[model samples]
Target: MHSKTASSSLSTSSRIVLPNDTNVLGNLMGGQLLNWMDITSAIAAHRHCGRVVVTAAVNNVSFNHPIALGDIVTIEAKVTRAFTSSMEVFMDVYVEHRLTGEKKKCNEAIYTFVAVDQNGKSIDVPELIPESEEEKSRYDAALRRRQLSLILAGRMNANEATELKALFEQ
Candidate 1:
């Protein structure tokens, strides 16, 4: 039950959906959305760790709605937790309608990153610094999600795991 001694935050990143960013369905492609998430999350992680960081895993990514072509996708990322050399980054993607300005949450992702030295060797990240109560809550929530993911992964047999995994699908 490790907890952060402090917390960190990074600026938001955004991308405009271009014609090529969409698929045959005229919705934004998952890969393009994932690339936005990964890059923004990495930037947040590096800002927190103050060094180069490499993604260790995208623990989870879930898309809740279709992002239509020309939608502006905004990704907000923050460091939710840190352990030794690794940090967990939580990102939420918002889609704003190009004309009406209506906004909806389209995706959420959790990514783990490992800080690295100039040699590309892993290095310990600074203790997370939580600057606000909200940030602290987000950190705690991330921990709970991690624990739930582990529990679901460990306890479920293949068939059950597959069923539960289906619930996480787009």
Candidate 2:
């Protein structure tokens, strides 16, 4: 398959936080935000490979700030790296102030997805090319994260994790 640029698979979704989506503290529920993020990230993965994708893992979700009810939340997701059949997607969650219209980044998340065929078997995905500096950084870091995940899952030995090993060697 041909390579695709990260920007090409960019997926964005925006929605207002309603009463049903919030907690007793009037803040948007984390699970609700995660659901939105999964859909957006899957869209990005599908756009990159043109096949149905499934969420394999949810990683690195950082809740830096609370999003109050009535705020507009925008989720932007893009493919950071692609392996044989899996892709690492990164998302930025921003909250727009209902009153001032100001936007601030409130959270970030990383998700892993695997492309599948109609029969539900794993399928190959195209390679991802990152252009911008931030994309490049995230793309490079994806390898290290993958290595760590594999090690923790007992699928990879520490000695075989060259990318992650290099980080500690430095």
Of the candidates shown, which would achieve the greatest TM-score relative to the real structure? 2
What is residue 40's positional error in candidate 2, in angstroms? 0.5
Q: Which consecutive 10 residues in model 2 have the weakest lDDT in total?
A: 146-155
The sequence of per-residue lDDT tens digits that candidate 2 reaches over residues 41-117 is 99999999999999988867988898999999999999999999999999999999999999998888999999999
* TM accuracy, model 1: 0.79
TM-score, each model?
Answer: 0.79, 0.96
| Model 2 backbone overlap count | 0
lDDT (tens digit, per residue) of candidate 1 on 3-107: 434334574887889999899989999999888888999988887777899987788898789898888999999898887888889888899999999988877
How good is model 2 by TM-score? Answer: 0.96
lDDT of 1 at 136: 80
